[model samples]
Target: MSTVPRYIREYVDVNVDFDKDGRMLPKTLIWEDGHRYEIDRIKAIQPAPALKAGGQGDRYTIVIKGHERYLFFEHNADYGDEKIGKWFVERKVAP
Candidate 1:
């Protein structure tokens, strides 16, 4: 079996859209590497607002390291709260 690379990441809720079922649709999360991941894992949904309020809450923290940065979207809704609104993406610095 092969191993998977992980990285310590943080996600913040960006936006939410309600469907006919009144259930929340896919939420956008800003990853640590300054990328956005859209996922529909209800359980992974976190209250974005609370996190900004400085209140204690649960967030999906993982370790990822590889060339597949796009794969981060697979673990969407893995952190932050729904109220988080939008998360800031870090800017790249020149070496």
Candidate 2:
């Protein structure tokens, strides 16, 4: 049998803050199901590939409730997405 994708793209709502010079920082992420998670800290931000999902943008290595997770932001307006872009996370699928 073919193995299904272990992860699926899940769009989430994020609350962001910007520094005086326009540096973006994510503060919280609301799940698709309306659950909100506060980002405890941001460890790193850099351009990286999005594995298991095609959307690629700046990757944020953040800690939420002491649990580490990767969040992605896809800001390609060429795809006709929102001008402000969107955020997404990979949700693991049970076997």
Candidate 3:
């Protein structure tokens, strides 16, 4: 029998800094349980493709202060012409 990995993904609320080109960059992270973590440094910010065509928004991998875990952000397309996408976070775990 195989055991499932303990790491389950979670959606989180985040505060970030954006460039003039409107890129999503993480600055602060707030969990659903109300714990806040300020980003002391960004270890990496790689773009994950949302669609084959383009412009569906992006996904990012970031590391915050005091933790060696991988934090993710998914910025999705507009919901019903709202002119803004949604953001979500997921923590990665080693298998």
Top TM-score: which candidate number? 2
Alpha-carbon deviation at 64 in model 1, angstroms: 12
Of candidates 2 and 1, the better by TM-score: 2
Candidate number with greatest lDDT:
2
C-alpha local distance difference test of each model:
0.39, 0.88, 0.59
lDDT digits (tens) for residues 1-95 of candidate 2 = 98785887788899999999897899999997888999999999999868876668899999999999999997866766557677899888875
Q: List the candidates' TM-scores in order.
A: 0.28, 0.84, 0.59
| Tens digits of lDDT, candidate 1, 1-95 | 76543333243445556899874444555555567655435444343323322323333232233212111222235366553333332223333
List the pairs of residues colliding in candidate 2: none
Query: What is the clash tally of candidate 2?
Result: 0
lDDT of candidate 1? 0.39
Tens-digit lDDT string for candidate 3 (1-95): 88554444466677878889986677877888999988776666666643322332355545565665455554444556753554555444665
* lDDT value, candidate 3, whole model: 0.59
Clashing residue pairs, candidate 3? none
Sorted by lDDT, highest first, which candidate order results? 2, 3, 1
Q: Which residue window of length 10 is worst by lDDT in model 2?
A: 76-85
**At residue 10, what lDDT does model 1 achieve?**
41
Please identify model 1 stretches exceeding 4 Å from their true place. Answer: 1-13, 44-95
Off by over 4 Å in 3: 49-59, 91-95
